[model samples]
Target: MTRVVFVLLPEVHLLDLAGPAQVFAGADGFGQPYTLDYVAERPQVLSAEGLPLVARTDWPVLGRDDLIMVPGWRGPVLRDGPVLHASAVERLRAHHAAGGTIASVCAGADALGQAGMLDGRRCTTHHQLQDELAARYPRATVVRDVLFTTDDRVVTSAGIASGIDLALHLLAARHGPALAARVARDMVVYARRNGNAPQASAMLRHRSHLDDTVHRVQSLIDTHYAEPLPLSRLAAHAGVSARTLTRLFAKATDGLTPLRYQQALRLERAEHLISQGTTVESAAREVGFEDARMLRRLRR
Candidate 1:
C-alpha cells in the first residue's frame, strides 16, 4: 500500500487540502492501495475557511514508496505565511534523502522551499504567489503558468484545484493512464488542460470537452488504443454513425479524427516504452503498430 501523508499547517486552504485528497481517495475507491493520513505540528489546525481540523502530531513510519504532501496555507505574504519549524523541515529533508516523494500545493511549496528542496529544482506554486516564491528562493527554478512540476520526487502544484491535476499525474505515472482516467471520471472532473497544464497523458489531455458521445468513444479507445479499431466499431460504442462520430470527435478535439486520437495514445505509450530501452520494433509491436516505420514517421 502507498501511504499518502498530508502535513497540515495553520490556516491551510480548504480546497488545497481537499482537492488532491479527494483524487487519491477516489483512487482508493478504484483499489489503488493508497492509505491517506493527516498530520500537523499541532493536534488541531484551523483551515483558512474557518473549519477546525484534527490530525496526528507524530509522523508515521514512511518508506520510499510513501508520499508526504504539504497542502498550501493562507498568507498574504511569505513573511506572514505558515512556517515549518526546524524539526519538520528536517523531516522533509530526511524523507527525500530516503528516496521518498514529497509534494506541495500553493503556499505549501514555501514549506518545501524552507526545507531547501526547491533549490535548483523546477517547481511551481499558485500564480498569485509565483513571483514572491521566485524571489525568495532564487536558487530554485520556479516555473510559472504550469499546473505542476516534478524534479526528482519533489512535486509542486499551483494552488486550489490544480492539486487534483498533480495527483492525477502521479497516479498516471504510477499505475497507468487507464486507471487514472477512471479515477478522473469517478471524480466527475474532465481533467482540464489550459494555459497551466499538467504533464497530461493523452487520455486526460484530449478529454477536456463536454460531449458525451465523444467521451464515450474516447473511453473505449483509452482502454483499447493498441487494438485495430475501425470507425464503424468506435461509432457503435458511441451510439453514433461512423460519419457523425468522425465529425463530433474532430470538433471536440480540435479537428482530431478518432483514428488520430488513438494513434496519439499509441504513440505516447510507444515513446514511454522506447525510453525504457525497448527497441523501436518492439515498442511498435507493443503499442499495436504494424512496424517501426510507422512509429518513426510519427516521431518525425
Candidate 2:
C-alpha cells in the first residue's frame, strides 16, 4: 500500500486536512488501499475551529511517502511567531529531497515557502494572502485567481474549499480520471474532475468598480444563456473590439475565458434550478444549453 501522511500543524483548518485525507483514504486504486496517517510537530494540535487533533506520530515519522499534505497553518499570529521549530523545516526538506510528492492547502503554502521549497515554483494560496506570498517568495510565480496550481513535484491550492479540488486533482493524477470522478461523485461534488473548470469560489468575492463592458457582457450571457449569443454583437454592445473584449473578459473575470465564464454561469443556474425540483432537461434549457445531452457532456 502507498503511504500517505498529513502533517498537521497548530491552527490547521479542519476541512483542509479532512478533505484530502478522506479522498486518499477512500481511494482504492491499483487494487490496494492507501495507508493514511496524521503526524504533527507534537502529539496534539488545535484546529482553527477550536477542535483538537491527536496525531499518531510526531516529526520523527517523516519519511518516504507517496504523498504528504500540509494543511494551512494557524492565522497571522502563528505565522509571525518566531517559535516555529527548525526541525520541522529540515524534515520537510529531507522528505522532498527523497522525492516525496508535496502538497499544501491554503496557507499551508506559507510553511513550504518558509522551508524554501516553493522557490521558483508556480503556486497559489487564498486570495487574501496573494500579495504577502508574492512579497515573501520573489522567485515563485504566485497566482491568486485559480483554485490550485501544480508545478512538477509541488502542488498548492487556494483557499479552504479549494483543498477538496486539489485532492480530487491528486487522485486523478495518481490513479486515473475515472477514479477521481468516482470520488468526486461520491462526495456530491461533480464539477472538479475537469481541470480548469470554473469553481464557485472564483466568483464569490465581488470586486468593486464594475467595468461596464464586462458587466454588460456577463449580464447578457446570464439572462440569455438559452439564446445563441454572437461574440461580435456582445463586443459591439460593450463598445469594445472583439479582441479587446476578450482581454477585458479575462482580466475582469479572474482569468476565465469569456465563453467559459458564460458556461459556468449557466451551469450554476442549472444547479439552482435542479435544486428547486426541475428536471435535468428543464434545467439544461433554462441554463441556455439547448440540449440536455450537451449539458451532460460538458459537465462530464
Candidate 3:
C-alpha cells in the first residue's frame, strides 16, 4: 500500500487540503491501494476559513512509493503567512532525500523552498505569488501560468483548484489514464493535463459515459494503447457484437469510434515522447504506428 501524508499548516486553505485528499481517497474507493494520513506541528490546526482541524504530530515510516504533500495556507500578505518550524522543513527534505515524493499546492511551495526541495527544481505556485516565489528562491526555476510542474520527484501546483489537476496527473502517471479517468468521472471533473499541453488529456477526452461495456473497452485500450487492437477483439473483450460495441462506444463518448479513441491515445503518447526529444520515427514505432507518415499527419 502507498502511504499519502498531508502536512497541515496554520490557516491552511480548505480546498487545497480537500482536493488532493479526495482524489487519492476516491482512487482508493475504486480499488487503488492508498492510505491517507494527516500530520501537523501541533495537535490541532486552524483553517483560513476559521474552521478547526485535528491532526497528528506523530510521523509514520515512509518508503520510496510513499508521498508527502503540503497544502497552501492563507495570510494577510504572501510573505506574512504562517511559518513552518525548522523541524518540519527538515522532515520534508529528509523525505525527498529518502526517495519519497514530496508535493505542494499554492503557497505550500514556500514550505518546500524552506526545505531546499525547490532548489534547482522547476516548480510553480499561485500566479499572484509567482514573482515573489522566484525572487525568494533564486535557485529554483519557477514556472508561471501552469496547472502544475514536477521536477526530480518534487511536484508543485498553481492555485487552489489546480490541486485536483495535480493529484489526477500523479494518479495517471502512477497507475494509468483509465483509472485516473474513472476517478475523475466519479468526482465529476475533467481530468485536465498538467503544464501547458494544449490538447485534452486522453483520460478526459474519452470520458463522459455511464455504459459499462464502453468502459471495459476503454480500460483495455487505455492500458495497452500502443498495441494493435481490432474491433473484433474489443467486441470479444466487451462480450458484444462488433456493431453493437461500435454503437455503444459512439453514444457513450460523444460519437467517437473505438478506433478513433485508440488513435487519440496513441497520438497523445507519441506527442509526449516527441516532446521529450524522441525522433518522429521512434515515437511512431513506440506508439504502435507502423510508420512515421501517419503519426506526422495526425500531429499536423
Question: For all candidates, what are the clash counts?
Answer: 0, 2, 0
Give per-model TM-scores. Answer: 0.66, 0.68, 0.66
Off by over 4 Å in 2: 29-32, 59-65, 74-84, 193-203, 206-264, 267-300
lDDT of 1 by residue, 1-300 (tens): 999999999999999999889988888899988899999988999999999999999988999999999999888787689779787898899999999999998899999999999999999998789899999999999888787899999999986788888888888889887787898888899642332443456787789999999999998998999999999999888888999999999999999999999999998888777755689999999999999999999989
lDDT of each: 0.88, 0.75, 0.88
Candidate 3, superposed: residue stretches over 4 Å from native: 197-300
- Model 2: how far residue 176 lies from native, Å: 0.7
Q: What overall lDDT, based on C-alpha atoms, would model 1 receive against the true structure?
A: 0.88
Q: Model 3 Cα RMSD, Å?
A: 10.9
- Please report the candidate that would top TM-score against the real structure: 2
Tens-digit per-residue lDDT, 1-300, candidate 2:
677778787788898998887777667643547878787768888898999999965543444557777888657532472233587677678788898778899888888888888898998888778788888889999976777888867888987878888988887777777787777777777556332433333244323327888878877766676677778978998899999999988887677666786676677667656654689899998777867997787667
Q: By the TM-score metric, which is better: model 2 or model 3? A: 2
> What are the candidates' C-alpha RMSDs?
8.2, 9.0, 10.9
- After superposition of all CA atoms, the RMSD between model 2 and the true structure is 9.0
